[model samples]
Target: MSLVRLSIKGISYSQTQNGAYALILNEVDGERKLPIVIGAFEAQSIAIALEKEIRPPRPLTHDLFKTFADRFDIVVKQVIIHKLVDGVFYSSMICERDKIEEIIDARTSDAIALALRFDAPIFTYKNILDKAGIYLNMSSEDKSDSEESDDILSTPETFGNTSSDEEIKNTYAKYTLAELNDLMDQAVQDEDYEKAAKIRDEITKRES
Candidate 1:
């Protein structure tokens, strides 16, 4: 199978599942994006790693793993998202130490978070991308229209795994698009990404 390199796009809260997030991966040389649902802690860990400016007072679990690996001289070479079964992604980490290499199984979210810390490249089989990737239309002339299209295209796929947790209620339904935009900006300024994501979803819903 041919491998395609991928890069972090961003993370957003799942609209349909409580405490779940969608991790978006962009094909490095293509237009498609791979969205995988991940848990809250993993999402936050990956977010912090991506931001590079927010340092947690204590090392998060992934951070501890990186520290431990450094102490042992283990180096992460790359990450491979090797499989997709029932809406879940499976990944492997290529690590090397003392001129020997090892492959370690990892959750897609965890693998990605560690990849950011280690500056490791991420790759997935072309077949996997064909099966799960989504494309965004970027040729539109209107900027807002293009962004709206992107949000619509990047929605999370639950794949029958959503639990019984009641979805977050829509309190912004009454607000106009203009007001919602202001609220979204405020949410982002407050660093409430989950709230910002929900607002963005509401705006997208209205736009669509």
Candidate 2:
């Protein structure tokens, strides 16, 4: 079966699902898109990586994994969105150590987060794409010709192709360092370490 490489295009808070976010993945070779519903923490993690934000003293789980991989010379080659079962998409990370490949089961959100951090491609089996893909209207004349270019065989371009960095910065800039610090404290009080890490990272980025 053929595979379709995808790159994240946009992430927005989903009002319908409280604390959930919509992750839009655009096809690398075509005009199709796939939108996945993911939790708030996962959204933050993906956003931080996409924006190249620096984390605080304590490493987040994904950060720790990246550090471990670097320390042991394990290269993350790609992250595969392998299947969708019972409304949940299954994913795996393809890592190479001494030329041996390893497949590790992971949540789609976590896999994507790590994939972005490691500069790895994200791919899905054709079957999975067939099940959940949504093709957007690309017929508008205003659409750039570059959008139709087939570059799936290479690294999927960064989120949103051109506007991701500016959007991320703007989105994050709304919160002051003190506000983010307070959010981090609240997250910790609630035992949401994942959210705390994200808030911490945002604060670090602003302060830096």
Candidate 3:
């Protein structure tokens, strides 16, 4: 399979949902962008990692996983967003143990959450990108055209008017540190790693 390297583009909250967000992944070499609908916690986790945020007193699950990996001397090389099916994106971690490589199935959100912890690259199959990608016309005159196209193609019901970078910063700005820390606790208590991740990110960004 042809691997399509990806990078974090931005994340936008689902305006219609209180606990959901859209995680946008962009192809490294092309304009293809895949927007995955992930839970707020997951969104926060990915965000925190991407933004290089600092954790509060308690370690989030992804953090614990990272700790465990370190304890075991395993290295996460990268994360592969391997597939998209039934409106869900699937991912895997490429890890090395004593020079041996292994692939493990993971929820896209968790995989990304962990990827951020490890400072690992994210990737996907070209076919998956082709299937779920969105393309924006960057021509100056096509602003409205791009907006319309994105609106039509967006997974989450509500689309933010802000550009990608601004949207992420805004989302991170929407919460207070204490509030995010509480949310992280709630997510962990509820066993929602995805939500926990998002909260972690928010805390990280605010601190940074």
Over the stretch 1-208, how does candidate 2's per-residue lDDT look in tens digits? 8889999876655444466665767789986666666777777778777776456567778888899999999988999888765345678899999999999988888899899989999999887776555544433653555345322110121111112345446755788777776765665444333344344444544554
lDDT comparison, 1 vs 2, better candidate:
1
Q: Report backbone clashes per prediction.
A: 0, 0, 11
How high is the lDDT of residue 20 in model 1? 81
User: Candidate 1 has what TM-score?
Assistant: 0.70
How far out, in Å, is residue 132 in model 1?
A: 0.5
Cα miss at 52, model 2 (Å)?
1.6
lDDT of 3 by residue, 1-208 (tens): 9998998766766554467777767788997666666776677677666665455478778888999999999988999877654445667899999999999988887888888788898888987776555554355655445444432112321112113445455766777778777766665444333344444444544565
Per-residue lDDT value at 203 in model 1 = 57
* Displacement of the residue 196 alpha carbon in candidate 3, Å: 26
> Candidate 1: worst 10 consecutive residues by lDDT?
152-161
The Cα error of candidate 1 at residue 185, in Å, is 26
The regions of model 3 sitting more than 4 angstroms off are 140-208
Better of 1 and 2 by TM-score: 1
- Candidate with top lDDT is 1
Error of 2 at 159 (Å): 19
